[model samples]
Target: MTRSESPDLSVRQRLHPSSPFFNAARHLKKLILPAIVVFLVAQAASWERWLFLFVVPSILYEIYRFFTVRFHFATGEMVVRDGWLFNNERHIPFERIQNIDFTQTLLQRWCGVAEVRLQTASGQEPEAVLRVLAVPVVEEMRRRVFEFGEQAGAEVPPDLTTGWESREREFEVEDDGSPSPAPVSDRLLLHLPPAALMKLGLIKNRGLGLVLAGMGLAWEFDLWERFDFVEKVRPWFSDATWQRIVLLVAGTVLAGFACLLLFSLVWTFFRLYDFRLTRHGDDFRLQCGMTTRLSATVPLHRIQFVSVQETVLHRAMGAVSLQVETAGGKSEGEENASMSRRWFAPLVTPGQLTDLVAEIRPGLSLEGLDWQGLDAVGRRRLRRRALFLALLLSAGLALLFRPWGGLAIAILVPYALLHSAREGMFLAFSHFAGGIAYRSGAFTRRTSVTFHDKSQVISLHESPFDRRYAMASLHVDTAGAGTAGHRIQIPYLSRGVAKSLGEELATQAEQAAFRWS
Candidate 1:
């Protein structure tokens, strides 16, 4: 279908009769059945059965209202009409849609239905959704909306601003009306690479071990019982000598925890095996599951950041988790020690990851990210700051843990020195036509690249110590995540370079146009 050629077309021009009223009613059957069951159960439990009289009319009226509502889906716009007595309608013009998301829930899967959500430009409730359509119908609707959105130059707002739609058309009937470009053949995209799969299973999460441990422990003992201090100690030590026994037991417990960390590390490795990543055009797909498989696709433009991470163990093994962040929601703040999203390779050979990054963003030349003379002043500043932090940590530990804490604090000295030096020596920045990229990390190195025109904001930061070092940090923010969030920060960079880069990016950001498609 094509968009209306006439410039004078109004919002109503795009309206079309919805599939069928029965389609909505039939699809809503599952939801309605549960509500009816709850209502009947409550009525049966009522004191005098009088409550049934009130509930029956209310439920019937609601059901009737929903059944009678008329919904419209068109290439250029979408409108829903509903009312019992006073009619009400909601509309979203094609040009105003910032995003169009199609999702399929488990229930929708059984019903062969999909949900289409539309986001608008107002920054408020950007879009509304119409759910429960047949898969084929949903695909057609998505294709048409996207085509129109492209024509209108409508901006598709990100669902989560991780950075990442259009109207209907009218055309002569073809022999068969089918959604253009059939869904990518599942067979073409479904190969299971053994190596990728192995990596995925080994590194997915440590919870697998925790679950096995919990189940084994539960099966072996009466886990529900809480041990009293004396009852617990009596098995190993006489109650009269419990104090001495308590000290010895504490030492063993500490040792056991240390050993568990080591074991957990090993267990985590073997579990995440056979990880694989494949690309189908703009869509990057990942499938890796041990007992049950997980399949996910991320559109290229939807990716907000690409992160490479290595733990202390990963560093020793020359391995890293290549993570790509998309417009998915913000982290729930839980401790997910492993990669959040799909990884390219959990056991990446050193130097190969840079090649992977270049492959992901072909336009950016990561290999050209020069660190040769990126201001030695900043490096000295970082070293001095590290020394000061080490001293402060030592003092704090001494105060908090007294004698024992003081010994713990001593550990910070080597860590601080090593991290500080690594941070200074490894840091690099590259300015390209598409974006500005920064790379730095000690244990788990990360390189974050933000396009100037695509960036929403540029911020500069400096601490008291940075002032002495004549150094500054620069951050670039994008739309969606808002201020202070989803920022790209370069720590301890030359003041001149930071200011110049920030100003350049800020200017481009101001000039770029905003879209809601």
Candidate 2:
């Protein structure tokens, strides 16, 4: 039904009774460490005892918050009101809502509750968050917000009921007959198998660096002495023989590596447990996570670009990852930069990648596209640049270490030359029916596809180095472009070619319809 014809949403609703406990738990979790420190200080010094007095009131305040918070559906907007001392209210229009995500932790799942987050294009934080609601209530809210576009300007559907009676009747048989199962619009596009997850764990060792940094900090703080770790290892050093020292160092390194490997495996598995990508009409839905379940949706129209990425090991295994860039912004306090943009496929074979892409974006194909390489002049410029950088590095090393560093140039020069040659050969770009693709990267290959319709800006750039060589770069900008500031970059192109390409991209962007929802 159209929004105008839909019933008014002035009927207020309150969260489940368990919400107060969950809110208190979250607050306690954040303050636990500080509380422990304060308690220890209080025990040692009487003056610090007053700090513990705040804990009881904090818990009571959270319980009070539950009574004040209220939400309701109002015309074309969702209204939320809360706060006892400092009154606050928020009105979020259905049209401005970009994504509605639901997340539930293990405890919440057991309690049959979920947290619903409403995201807008503001790029600051979620417009509204309904924390600790019944599972059925969460589902009803998501259905209304996400499906609002399809039913806009139409009468509300008869089955779109949020009343308690309707929710109870959902699982009961109808009087006429057992109703057929609701038509399933969401189709599974990809699922990461256990074997693929293991492979990903092995190839992506992101946490190892963090572990090493932690060890360094521990050593700096004299943790080894406090923990008697140095005393345990001193026996081996007492021998002071080359063989003993070598074996001791090697064993320690291998043990640390093994621990890191196991940590990565378990961490990856838990983070991506039961990963599933599904296509729901013109939108995409991603559901995953073990301890904390997360469900996110991406409208097809909001996708600005698609990236097919492969690491050195991933390429060798014939597997790739698919990520889409959307106009959605990151939620507040989200530390993982990559988490804001959901992955379409974390691990997929080439064949699976092709099928998944085709299903999501019809008429776009990555296979058999005609690729054009950089001109000889551009290639020469890249090689020269690489060589100059290598020379500078070699000079610095020689100045710092004298004779020993002088020998390092023998290794660096040839390695630099080989890298330059490889980059020159691999740098290329191609145009497809729907979008333009740029292929680059020496060791880890990445191909980014940006649709003409989503293109926001096209420009030509030149630095002093490029000016000397009469070379320029063409860049295409779109919504949600990464730190690189461009979705597609073809560097070291001739001045004329760069300008022509920029003009063509600008024309296409202007002529194409703008549908960035």
Each prediction's TM-score versus the true structure: 0.58, 0.82
lDDT of 2 by residue, 177-263 (tens): 777355444567887877888888887775697687667766654556555887887887996898989987999999988888888
Best by TM-score: 2
- Model 1 bad stretches (over 4 Å): 1-72, 77-194, 204-306, 310-360, 372-375, 480-486, 507-517
Report, for every candidate in turn, its global Cα lDDT versus the true structure. 0.52, 0.73
Please report the candidate that would top lDDT against the real structure: 2
**Total residue pair clashes for candidate 1:** 44
lDDT of 1 by residue, 432-477 (tens): 6667766776666666665554466678999897787677888776
